[model samples]
Target: MMRRVRAKKFLGQHFLEDLGIARRITESLSIPPSHVVEVGPGMGVLTQFLVQREDLDLYLVEIDSESVEYLHQHYPQLSNRIIEGDFLKFDFNKIFPDKFSIIGNFPYNISSQIFFKVFDNRNHVDKVVGMVQREVGRRIASGPGSKEYGILSVLLQSYYTIEYLMTVDEHVFSPPPKVKSGVIRLVRNEVDKLPCDERLFVKVVKAAFQHRRKTMRNSLKYVEFDHGAIMHLPVFDLRPEQMSVEAFQELTKLIEEHPLCE
Candidate 1:
Protein backbone atom coordinates (compact mmCIF):
# COMPACT_ATOMS: atom_id res chain seq x y z
CA MET A 1 0.00 0.00 0.00
CA MET A 2 1.25 3.51 -0.84
CA ARG A 3 1.52 5.90 2.08
CA ARG A 4 -0.03 9.35 1.54
CA VAL A 5 2.39 12.26 1.59
CA ARG A 6 1.53 14.90 4.18
CA ALA A 7 1.38 18.52 3.10
CA LYS A 8 4.19 20.53 4.67
CA LYS A 9 3.00 23.98 5.72
CA PHE A 10 6.48 25.47 5.60
CA LEU A 11 6.77 24.42 1.95
CA GLY A 12 3.33 25.88 1.15
CA GLN A 13 2.15 22.52 -0.16
CA HIS A 14 -1.60 22.55 -0.77
CA PHE A 15 -2.06 19.32 -2.71
CA LEU A 16 -4.79 19.66 -5.32
CA GLU A 17 -7.01 16.67 -4.53
CA ASP A 18 -9.65 17.31 -7.20
CA LEU A 19 -8.87 15.27 -10.28
CA GLY A 20 -11.25 17.30 -12.45
CA ILE A 21 -9.51 20.54 -11.54
CA ALA A 22 -6.14 18.89 -12.04
CA ARG A 23 -7.18 17.78 -15.54
CA ARG A 24 -8.37 21.30 -16.32
CA ILE A 25 -5.04 22.74 -15.17
CA THR A 26 -3.22 20.24 -17.34
CA GLU A 27 -5.31 21.09 -20.38
CA SER A 28 -4.61 24.79 -19.83
CA LEU A 29 -1.11 24.33 -21.24
CA SER A 30 -0.52 26.22 -24.47
CA ILE A 31 -1.36 24.08 -27.52
CA PRO A 32 1.36 22.10 -29.32
CA PRO A 33 3.16 21.67 -26.02
CA SER A 34 6.89 21.07 -26.30
CA HIS A 35 9.13 20.45 -23.30
CA VAL A 36 7.35 21.26 -20.01
CA VAL A 37 8.74 21.62 -16.48
CA GLU A 38 6.34 20.98 -13.57
CA VAL A 39 7.33 22.71 -10.32
CA GLY A 40 6.46 21.35 -6.83
CA PRO A 41 4.37 18.49 -8.27
CA GLY A 42 2.86 16.90 -5.12
CA MET A 43 1.77 13.20 -5.19
CA GLY A 44 1.96 13.19 -9.00
CA VAL A 45 -1.49 14.67 -9.31
CA LEU A 46 -0.45 16.73 -12.33
CA THR A 47 2.31 14.33 -13.33
CA GLN A 48 -0.23 11.57 -13.91
CA PHE A 49 -2.01 13.61 -16.58
CA LEU A 50 1.11 15.16 -18.08
CA VAL A 51 2.68 11.73 -18.68
CA GLN A 52 -0.35 10.56 -20.66
CA ARG A 53 0.54 12.97 -23.42
CA GLU A 54 3.06 11.27 -25.71
CA ASP A 55 4.50 14.40 -27.26
CA LEU A 56 5.58 16.37 -24.17
CA ASP A 57 9.15 16.05 -22.91
CA LEU A 58 8.19 16.47 -19.26
CA TYR A 59 10.51 17.22 -16.31
CA LEU A 60 9.56 17.38 -12.62
CA VAL A 61 11.32 19.55 -10.02
CA GLU A 62 10.67 18.55 -6.40
CA ILE A 63 12.69 19.90 -3.48
CA ASP A 64 11.07 17.55 -0.96
CA SER A 65 12.98 14.26 -0.80
CA GLU A 66 9.90 12.35 0.34
CA SER A 67 7.86 13.36 -2.71
CA VAL A 68 10.82 12.66 -5.00
CA GLU A 69 11.10 9.17 -3.60
CA TYR A 70 7.35 8.62 -3.97
CA LEU A 71 7.38 9.83 -7.59
CA HIS A 72 10.34 7.59 -8.41
CA GLN A 73 8.64 4.59 -6.87
CA HIS A 74 5.34 5.25 -8.67
CA TYR A 75 6.50 6.66 -12.00
CA PRO A 76 9.47 4.50 -12.97
CA GLN A 77 9.44 5.54 -16.63
CA LEU A 78 10.64 9.05 -15.74
CA SER A 79 13.93 7.65 -14.43
CA ASN A 80 16.25 10.53 -15.26
CA ARG A 81 13.77 13.37 -15.72
CA ILE A 82 12.71 14.08 -12.13
CA ILE A 83 15.12 16.68 -10.75
CA GLU A 84 15.43 16.62 -6.96
CA GLY A 85 16.11 20.31 -6.27
CA ASP A 86 14.74 23.83 -6.03
CA PHE A 87 13.25 25.27 -9.24
CA LEU A 88 14.74 28.70 -8.50
CA LYS A 89 18.27 27.27 -8.40
CA PHE A 90 17.86 24.66 -11.14
CA ASP A 91 19.60 25.71 -14.37
CA PHE A 92 17.14 25.61 -17.28
CA ASN A 93 19.97 26.14 -19.78
CA LYS A 94 21.71 22.91 -18.73
CA ILE A 95 18.72 20.59 -19.25
CA PHE A 96 16.79 22.45 -21.98
CA PRO A 97 19.35 23.83 -24.44
CA ASP A 98 16.58 25.36 -26.53
CA LYS A 99 13.10 26.50 -25.41
CA PHE A 100 10.49 25.14 -22.97
CA SER A 101 7.34 26.02 -21.05
CA ILE A 102 6.54 25.93 -17.28
CA ILE A 103 3.42 24.49 -15.66
CA GLY A 104 2.57 23.75 -12.02
CA ASN A 105 0.44 24.18 -8.92
CA PHE A 106 3.04 26.63 -7.59
CA PRO A 107 3.51 26.92 -3.83
CA TYR A 108 1.75 30.18 -2.99
CA ASN A 109 4.66 31.31 -0.81
CA ILE A 110 7.24 31.16 -3.58
CA SER A 111 5.06 31.98 -6.60
CA SER A 112 6.47 35.52 -6.86
CA GLN A 113 10.02 34.19 -6.74
CA ILE A 114 9.15 31.70 -9.50
CA PHE A 115 7.97 34.57 -11.72
CA PHE A 116 11.30 36.31 -11.14
CA LYS A 117 13.10 33.16 -12.29
CA VAL A 118 10.96 33.17 -15.44
CA PHE A 119 11.84 36.82 -16.09
CA ASP A 120 15.59 36.15 -15.76
CA ASN A 121 15.37 33.33 -18.32
CA ARG A 122 12.74 34.91 -20.57
CA ASN A 123 14.58 33.92 -23.73
CA HIS A 124 14.35 30.21 -22.93
CA VAL A 125 10.95 30.10 -21.22
CA ASP A 126 8.45 30.51 -24.05
CA LYS A 127 5.24 30.09 -22.04
CA VAL A 128 4.01 29.52 -18.49
CA VAL A 129 0.70 28.22 -17.14
CA GLY A 130 0.36 27.90 -13.39
CA MET A 131 -1.94 28.17 -10.38
CA VAL A 132 -1.18 30.74 -7.68
CA GLN A 133 -2.92 32.72 -4.95
CA ARG A 134 -5.81 34.63 -6.56
CA GLU A 135 -4.54 38.05 -5.56
CA VAL A 136 -1.10 37.32 -6.90
CA GLY A 137 -2.56 36.17 -10.25
CA ARG A 138 -4.61 39.35 -10.49
CA ARG A 139 -1.52 41.47 -9.85
CA ILE A 140 0.49 39.66 -12.52
CA ALA A 141 -2.23 40.03 -15.16
CA SER A 142 -3.11 43.59 -14.26
CA GLY A 143 -2.29 46.43 -16.67
CA PRO A 144 -1.52 50.02 -15.77
CA GLY A 145 -4.04 52.28 -13.91
CA SER A 146 -5.05 49.61 -11.37
CA LYS A 147 -3.75 49.13 -7.79
CA GLU A 148 -2.64 45.57 -8.67
CA TYR A 149 -0.30 46.95 -11.35
CA GLY A 150 3.04 47.16 -9.55
CA ILE A 151 6.61 45.90 -9.84
CA LEU A 152 6.02 42.29 -10.96
CA SER A 153 3.25 43.42 -13.31
CA VAL A 154 5.46 46.06 -14.95
CA LEU A 155 8.60 43.94 -15.18
CA LEU A 156 7.08 40.80 -16.71
CA GLN A 157 4.62 42.73 -18.92
CA SER A 158 7.60 44.27 -20.71
CA TYR A 159 8.56 40.84 -22.07
CA TYR A 160 5.40 38.71 -22.00
CA THR A 161 1.66 38.94 -22.48
CA ILE A 162 -0.11 37.71 -19.33
CA GLU A 163 -3.64 36.33 -19.11
CA TYR A 164 -5.59 35.63 -15.92
CA LEU A 165 -7.14 32.27 -16.80
CA MET A 166 -9.56 31.20 -14.10
CA THR A 167 -10.57 31.64 -10.45
CA VAL A 168 -10.54 28.38 -8.41
CA ASP A 169 -12.45 27.85 -5.20
CA GLU A 170 -10.70 26.82 -1.96
CA HIS A 171 -12.66 23.56 -1.46
CA VAL A 172 -10.84 21.65 -4.24
CA PHE A 173 -7.60 20.94 -2.35
CA SER A 174 -6.74 18.15 0.14
CA PRO A 175 -6.19 20.58 2.99
CA PRO A 176 -8.09 23.61 1.78
CA PRO A 177 -6.19 26.88 1.75
CA LYS A 178 -7.65 29.94 3.45
CA VAL A 179 -7.60 31.86 0.19
CA LYS A 180 -8.87 30.95 -3.28
CA SER A 181 -6.47 30.33 -6.19
CA GLY A 182 -6.30 31.51 -9.78
CA VAL A 183 -4.68 30.22 -12.96
CA ILE A 184 -2.62 32.39 -15.31
CA ARG A 185 -0.71 32.11 -18.59
CA LEU A 186 2.22 34.16 -19.88
CA VAL A 187 3.24 33.98 -23.56
CA ARG A 188 6.55 35.45 -24.62
CA ASN A 189 5.93 38.52 -26.79
CA GLU A 190 7.71 39.97 -29.83
CA VAL A 191 9.75 42.43 -27.75
CA ASP A 192 13.01 40.53 -27.50
CA LYS A 193 14.56 43.16 -25.21
CA LEU A 194 13.87 46.59 -23.83
CA PRO A 195 15.92 49.33 -25.47
CA CYS A 196 17.34 50.54 -22.12
CA ASP A 197 19.73 48.75 -19.76
CA GLU A 198 17.83 45.70 -18.41
CA ARG A 199 19.43 45.93 -14.96
CA LEU A 200 18.76 49.68 -14.74
CA PHE A 201 15.18 49.05 -15.89
CA VAL A 202 14.57 46.64 -12.99
CA LYS A 203 16.22 49.04 -10.52
CA VAL A 204 14.02 51.93 -11.69
CA VAL A 205 10.77 49.94 -11.43
CA LYS A 206 11.60 48.69 -7.91
CA ALA A 207 12.62 52.14 -6.70
CA ALA A 208 9.47 53.82 -7.96
CA PHE A 209 7.09 51.29 -6.43
CA GLN A 210 9.03 51.19 -3.12
CA HIS A 211 7.75 54.72 -2.66
CA ARG A 212 4.48 54.29 -4.63
CA ARG A 213 2.47 56.87 -2.73
CA LYS A 214 4.69 59.83 -3.59
CA THR A 215 4.65 61.34 -7.06
CA MET A 216 7.59 60.50 -9.34
CA ARG A 217 9.49 63.56 -8.09
CA ASN A 218 9.53 62.26 -4.53
CA SER A 219 9.73 58.53 -5.40
CA LEU A 220 12.54 59.10 -7.91
CA LYS A 221 14.64 60.84 -5.28
CA TYR A 222 15.91 57.30 -4.77
CA VAL A 223 17.42 57.85 -8.23
CA GLU A 224 20.17 60.46 -7.78
CA PHE A 225 20.03 63.64 -9.88
CA ASP A 226 20.29 67.45 -9.57
CA HIS A 227 16.51 67.16 -8.78
CA GLY A 228 15.75 70.30 -10.79
CA ALA A 229 16.75 69.17 -14.32
CA ILE A 230 13.98 66.57 -14.88
CA MET A 231 11.44 67.93 -12.39
CA HIS A 232 9.69 69.90 -15.16
CA LEU A 233 9.09 66.68 -17.12
CA PRO A 234 5.39 65.69 -16.94
CA VAL A 235 6.20 62.16 -15.73
CA PHE A 236 7.71 63.56 -12.52
CA ASP A 237 4.21 64.65 -11.44
CA LEU A 238 2.77 61.11 -11.75
CA ARG A 239 2.86 58.39 -9.06
CA PRO A 240 4.54 55.01 -9.56
CA GLU A 241 1.20 53.26 -9.84
CA GLN A 242 0.20 55.65 -12.64
CA MET A 243 3.22 54.99 -14.86
CA SER A 244 3.02 52.18 -17.44
CA VAL A 245 5.85 49.81 -18.40
CA GLU A 246 6.72 52.04 -21.37
CA ALA A 247 6.73 55.10 -19.09
CA PHE A 248 9.23 53.38 -16.80
CA GLN A 249 11.36 52.41 -19.82
CA GLU A 250 11.41 56.01 -20.96
CA LEU A 251 12.36 57.10 -17.44
CA THR A 252 15.18 54.52 -17.35
CA LYS A 253 16.55 55.81 -20.66
CA LEU A 254 16.26 59.38 -19.37
CA ILE A 255 18.21 58.53 -16.20
CA GLU A 256 20.82 56.59 -18.18
CA GLU A 257 21.60 59.52 -20.49
CA HIS A 258 21.34 62.33 -17.90
CA PRO A 259 24.19 63.26 -15.53
CA LEU A 260 23.94 62.03 -11.95
CA CYS A 261 24.85 64.10 -8.88
CA GLU A 262 28.02 62.70 -7.26
Candidate 2:
Protein backbone atom coordinates (compact mmCIF):
# COMPACT_ATOMS: atom_id res chain seq x y z
CA MET A 1 0.00 0.00 0.00
CA MET A 2 1.25 3.50 -0.82
CA ARG A 3 2.03 5.43 2.37
CA ARG A 4 0.26 8.71 1.66
CA VAL A 5 1.42 11.60 3.86
CA ARG A 6 -1.11 13.89 5.52
CA ALA A 7 -2.91 15.82 2.77
CA LYS A 8 -1.52 19.33 2.27
CA LYS A 9 -3.56 21.79 4.34
CA PHE A 10 -2.23 24.88 2.52
CA LEU A 11 -3.82 23.50 -0.65
CA GLY A 12 -7.17 22.83 1.10
CA GLN A 13 -6.24 19.20 0.57
CA HIS A 14 -8.70 16.61 1.82
CA PHE A 15 -7.77 13.45 0.00
CA LEU A 16 -10.84 11.27 -0.60
CA GLU A 17 -10.36 7.72 0.87
CA ASP A 18 -13.59 5.90 0.10
CA LEU A 19 -13.40 3.91 -3.14
CA GLY A 20 -17.21 3.90 -3.20
CA ILE A 21 -17.21 7.71 -3.19
CA ALA A 22 -14.59 7.78 -5.95
CA ARG A 23 -16.57 5.33 -8.08
CA ARG A 24 -19.81 7.23 -7.45
CA ILE A 25 -18.23 10.57 -8.38
CA THR A 26 -16.87 9.15 -11.64
CA GLU A 27 -20.10 7.32 -12.36
CA SER A 28 -21.95 10.65 -12.11
CA LEU A 29 -19.90 11.77 -15.11
CA SER A 30 -21.15 10.26 -18.38
CA ILE A 31 -18.28 11.62 -20.46
CA PRO A 32 -18.00 10.66 -24.06
CA PRO A 33 -15.25 8.29 -25.13
CA SER A 34 -13.31 11.36 -26.18
CA HIS A 35 -12.32 13.57 -23.14
CA VAL A 36 -12.48 14.73 -19.48
CA VAL A 37 -10.48 17.00 -17.11
CA GLU A 38 -9.93 16.29 -13.39
CA VAL A 39 -8.63 19.08 -11.16
CA GLY A 40 -6.94 18.76 -7.77
CA PRO A 41 -6.17 15.03 -8.22
CA GLY A 42 -4.41 14.49 -4.87
CA MET A 43 -2.71 11.10 -4.19
CA GLY A 44 -4.29 9.66 -7.38
CA VAL A 45 -7.10 7.82 -5.54
CA LEU A 46 -9.72 9.12 -7.95
CA THR A 47 -7.19 9.29 -10.77
CA GLN A 48 -6.53 5.57 -10.44
CA PHE A 49 -10.21 4.77 -10.92
CA LEU A 50 -10.72 7.32 -13.71
CA VAL A 51 -7.87 6.09 -15.94
CA GLN A 52 -8.97 2.47 -15.77
CA ARG A 53 -12.12 3.40 -17.64
CA GLU A 54 -11.25 2.93 -21.33
CA ASP A 55 -13.83 5.42 -22.56
CA LEU A 56 -12.37 8.71 -21.30
CA ASP A 57 -9.17 10.38 -22.49
CA LEU A 58 -8.51 11.46 -18.87
CA TYR A 59 -6.27 14.41 -17.97
CA LEU A 60 -5.22 15.54 -14.49
CA VAL A 61 -4.37 19.01 -13.20
CA GLU A 62 -2.57 19.26 -9.85
CA ILE A 63 -0.99 22.29 -8.19
CA ASP A 64 1.14 20.65 -5.50
CA SER A 65 4.61 20.01 -6.97
CA GLU A 66 5.22 17.02 -4.71
CA SER A 67 1.92 15.36 -5.65
CA VAL A 68 2.40 16.20 -9.32
CA GLU A 69 5.78 14.47 -9.34
CA TYR A 70 4.44 11.57 -7.30
CA LEU A 71 1.51 11.07 -9.65
CA HIS A 72 3.79 11.26 -12.67
CA GLN A 73 6.11 8.59 -11.27
CA HIS A 74 3.41 6.25 -9.98
CA TYR A 75 0.87 6.63 -12.78
CA PRO A 76 3.22 6.37 -15.73
CA GLN A 77 0.27 6.23 -18.14
CA LEU A 78 -0.74 9.74 -16.98
CA SER A 79 2.73 11.30 -17.18
CA ASN A 80 1.88 13.14 -20.40
CA ARG A 81 -1.57 14.24 -19.23
CA ILE A 82 -0.67 15.51 -15.73
CA ILE A 83 -0.44 19.30 -15.80
CA GLU A 84 1.53 21.04 -13.07
CA GLY A 85 -0.17 24.37 -12.24
CA ASP A 86 -2.94 26.02 -10.25
CA PHE A 87 -6.27 24.98 -11.74
CA LEU A 88 -7.57 28.54 -11.22
CA LYS A 89 -4.74 29.94 -13.36
CA PHE A 90 -4.84 27.35 -16.15
CA ASP A 91 -6.92 28.05 -19.29
CA PHE A 92 -9.16 25.04 -20.05
CA ASN A 93 -9.90 25.99 -23.68
CA LYS A 94 -6.18 26.07 -24.49
CA ILE A 95 -5.69 22.53 -23.16
CA PHE A 96 -8.77 20.62 -24.26
CA PRO A 97 -9.39 22.67 -27.44
CA ASP A 98 -12.83 21.07 -27.55
CA LYS A 99 -15.87 20.60 -25.34
CA PHE A 100 -15.02 18.57 -22.18
CA SER A 101 -16.27 17.34 -18.81
CA ILE A 102 -14.76 18.77 -15.55
CA ILE A 103 -14.49 16.98 -12.20
CA GLY A 104 -12.65 17.81 -9.00
CA ASN A 105 -12.44 17.70 -5.23
CA PHE A 106 -11.89 21.49 -5.19
CA PRO A 107 -9.98 23.17 -2.40
CA TYR A 108 -12.43 24.60 0.13
CA ASN A 109 -10.50 27.88 0.46
CA ILE A 110 -11.32 28.90 -3.13
CA SER A 111 -14.27 26.63 -3.91
CA SER A 112 -16.56 29.58 -4.74
CA GLN A 113 -13.90 31.10 -6.97
CA ILE A 114 -13.58 27.74 -8.71
CA PHE A 115 -17.27 27.92 -9.64
CA PHE A 116 -16.74 31.32 -11.25
CA LYS A 117 -13.81 29.87 -13.18
CA VAL A 118 -16.02 27.03 -14.39
CA PHE A 119 -18.75 29.55 -15.26
CA ASP A 120 -16.26 31.43 -17.43
CA ASN A 121 -15.50 28.27 -19.37
CA ARG A 122 -19.07 26.97 -19.41
CA ASN A 123 -19.01 27.04 -23.19
CA HIS A 124 -15.97 24.80 -23.38
CA VAL A 125 -17.06 22.54 -20.52
CA ASP A 126 -20.26 20.67 -21.26
CA LYS A 127 -20.72 19.63 -17.62
CA VAL A 128 -19.04 20.00 -14.19
CA VAL A 129 -19.15 17.41 -11.38
CA GLY A 130 -17.30 18.11 -8.17
CA MET A 131 -17.34 18.11 -4.40
CA VAL A 132 -17.91 21.41 -2.53
CA GLN A 133 -19.14 22.66 0.86
CA ARG A 134 -22.74 21.54 1.33
CA GLU A 135 -23.89 25.15 1.72
CA VAL A 136 -22.43 26.08 -1.63
CA GLY A 137 -23.93 23.00 -3.24
CA ARG A 138 -27.35 24.02 -1.89
CA ARG A 139 -26.90 27.60 -3.11
CA ILE A 140 -25.98 26.50 -6.61
CA ALA A 141 -29.00 24.23 -6.89
CA SER A 142 -31.30 26.59 -5.04
CA GLY A 143 -34.47 27.98 -6.56
CA PRO A 144 -35.79 31.54 -6.71
CA GLY A 145 -37.57 31.62 -3.34
CA SER A 146 -34.93 29.86 -1.26
CA LYS A 147 -32.74 31.79 1.19
CA GLU A 148 -29.69 30.11 -0.33
CA TYR A 149 -30.52 31.71 -3.68
CA GLY A 150 -28.28 34.63 -4.57
CA ILE A 151 -25.72 35.70 -7.18
CA LEU A 152 -24.39 32.15 -7.63
CA SER A 153 -27.89 30.75 -7.92
CA VAL A 154 -28.85 33.34 -10.51
CA LEU A 155 -25.62 33.26 -12.51
CA LEU A 156 -25.23 29.49 -12.66
CA GLN A 157 -28.91 28.85 -13.40
CA SER A 158 -28.65 31.23 -16.35
CA TYR A 159 -26.39 28.74 -18.12
CA TYR A 160 -26.70 25.24 -16.69
CA THR A 161 -28.97 22.84 -14.84
CA ILE A 162 -27.37 22.63 -11.38
CA GLU A 163 -28.20 19.72 -9.08
CA TYR A 164 -26.89 18.58 -5.70
CA LEU A 165 -26.21 14.86 -5.93
CA MET A 166 -25.38 13.58 -2.43
CA THR A 167 -23.56 14.55 0.69
CA VAL A 168 -20.34 12.95 1.99
CA ASP A 169 -19.44 12.78 5.66
CA GLU A 170 -16.29 14.55 6.91
CA HIS A 171 -14.84 11.14 7.84
CA VAL A 172 -14.64 10.37 4.12
CA PHE A 173 -11.41 12.36 3.71
CA SER A 174 -7.83 11.78 4.88
CA PRO A 175 -7.96 14.93 7.00
CA PRO A 176 -11.63 15.56 7.70
CA PRO A 177 -13.04 18.97 6.89
CA LYS A 178 -14.95 20.80 9.60
CA VAL A 179 -18.13 20.69 7.54
CA LYS A 180 -19.75 18.05 5.38
CA SER A 181 -19.39 18.33 1.60
CA GLY A 182 -21.66 17.47 -1.28
CA VAL A 183 -21.18 16.66 -4.95
CA ILE A 184 -22.96 18.69 -7.65
CA ARG A 185 -23.28 18.38 -11.39
CA LEU A 186 -23.80 21.27 -13.82
CA VAL A 187 -25.05 20.24 -17.22
CA ARG A 188 -25.04 22.88 -19.96
CA ASN A 189 -28.19 23.47 -21.95
CA GLU A 190 -28.13 24.56 -25.58
CA VAL A 191 -31.15 26.77 -24.96
CA ASP A 192 -29.26 28.75 -22.32
CA LYS A 193 -28.43 32.24 -23.51
CA LEU A 194 -26.17 34.91 -22.07
CA PRO A 195 -28.67 37.56 -23.38
CA CYS A 196 -26.06 40.27 -22.63
CA ASP A 197 -22.43 40.62 -21.62
CA GLU A 198 -22.07 37.72 -19.15
CA ARG A 199 -19.38 39.59 -17.22
CA LEU A 200 -21.71 42.55 -16.85
CA PHE A 201 -24.57 40.23 -15.92
CA VAL A 202 -22.52 38.90 -12.99
CA LYS A 203 -21.56 42.41 -11.98
CA VAL A 204 -25.21 43.46 -11.98
CA VAL A 205 -26.24 40.33 -10.07
CA LYS A 206 -23.62 40.92 -7.40
CA ALA A 207 -24.62 44.53 -6.99
CA ALA A 208 -28.27 43.64 -6.58
CA PHE A 209 -27.66 40.79 -4.12
CA GLN A 210 -25.32 42.98 -2.09
CA HIS A 211 -28.41 45.06 -1.40
CA ARG A 212 -30.97 42.31 -1.79
CA ARG A 213 -33.43 43.98 0.52
CA LYS A 214 -33.57 47.06 -1.66
CA THR A 215 -35.96 47.41 -4.56
CA MET A 216 -34.59 47.35 -8.13
CA ARG A 217 -35.06 51.12 -8.24
CA ASN A 218 -32.69 51.36 -5.28
CA SER A 219 -30.30 48.60 -6.46
CA LEU A 220 -30.15 50.14 -9.94
CA LYS A 221 -28.43 53.11 -8.34
CA TYR A 222 -25.47 50.86 -7.48
CA VAL A 223 -25.13 49.80 -11.11
CA GLU A 224 -24.42 52.45 -13.77
CA PHE A 225 -27.43 53.05 -15.97
CA ASP A 226 -29.65 55.80 -17.26
CA HIS A 227 -32.24 56.41 -14.56
CA GLY A 228 -34.53 57.60 -17.31
CA ALA A 229 -34.25 54.26 -19.18
CA ILE A 230 -34.53 52.18 -16.00
CA MET A 231 -37.76 53.98 -15.14
CA HIS A 232 -39.14 52.34 -18.26
CA LEU A 233 -38.41 48.83 -16.88
CA PRO A 234 -41.54 46.92 -15.97
CA VAL A 235 -40.97 46.45 -12.23
CA PHE A 236 -38.64 48.99 -10.68
CA ASP A 237 -40.31 48.46 -7.28
CA LEU A 238 -39.33 44.73 -7.10
CA ARG A 239 -36.28 43.67 -5.09
CA PRO A 240 -33.37 42.05 -6.91
CA GLU A 241 -33.85 38.54 -5.57
CA GLN A 242 -37.55 38.83 -6.16
CA MET A 243 -37.03 39.04 -9.91
CA SER A 244 -36.48 35.98 -12.10
CA VAL A 245 -33.62 35.28 -14.53
CA GLU A 246 -35.63 36.58 -17.48
CA ALA A 247 -36.15 39.90 -15.78
CA PHE A 248 -32.38 40.14 -15.22
CA GLN A 249 -31.72 39.48 -18.89
CA GLU A 250 -34.25 42.10 -19.96
CA LEU A 251 -32.92 44.68 -17.51
CA THR A 252 -29.30 44.07 -18.53
CA LYS A 253 -30.19 44.20 -22.22
CA LEU A 254 -31.89 47.54 -21.73
CA ILE A 255 -29.13 48.84 -19.46
CA GLU A 256 -26.40 48.00 -21.98
CA GLU A 257 -28.37 49.67 -24.73
CA HIS A 258 -28.34 52.81 -22.58
CA PRO A 259 -24.96 52.92 -20.80
CA LEU A 260 -24.55 56.13 -18.78
CA CYS A 261 -22.69 58.31 -21.28
CA GLU A 262 -20.15 60.09 -19.06
**Model 2 agreement with the true structure over 1-262: per-residue lDDT tens digits:** 4456457788899988999999999888876786788889988877888888998889998888888878887899888899999888988767777788888888888889988887878777788899999999998888766778888888888889888999999998889999999999999877546778776788888888888888877776867777885575657888876778878877778778888879
Best candidate, lDDT: 1
Taking all chains together, each candidate's TM-score versus the true structure is 0.96, 0.92
Query: Distance (Å) between predicted and true CA of 30, model 2?
Result: 0.7
Could you tell me which residue pairs clash in candidate 1?
Answer: none
Report the alpha-carbon TM-score of model 2 versus the true structure: 0.92
- Per-residue CA lDDT of candidate 1, range 1-262, in tens? 4798888999999999889988988888855748999999979999999999977899999998889989998898996999999999999878988989999999988999999999999999889999999999999999889988899999999999999989999999878999999999999999987989889899889888998888888887867655667778899999988898898999988888776766
User: Among all windows of ten consecutive residues in candidate 2, which has the lowest summed lDDT?
Assistant: 1-10
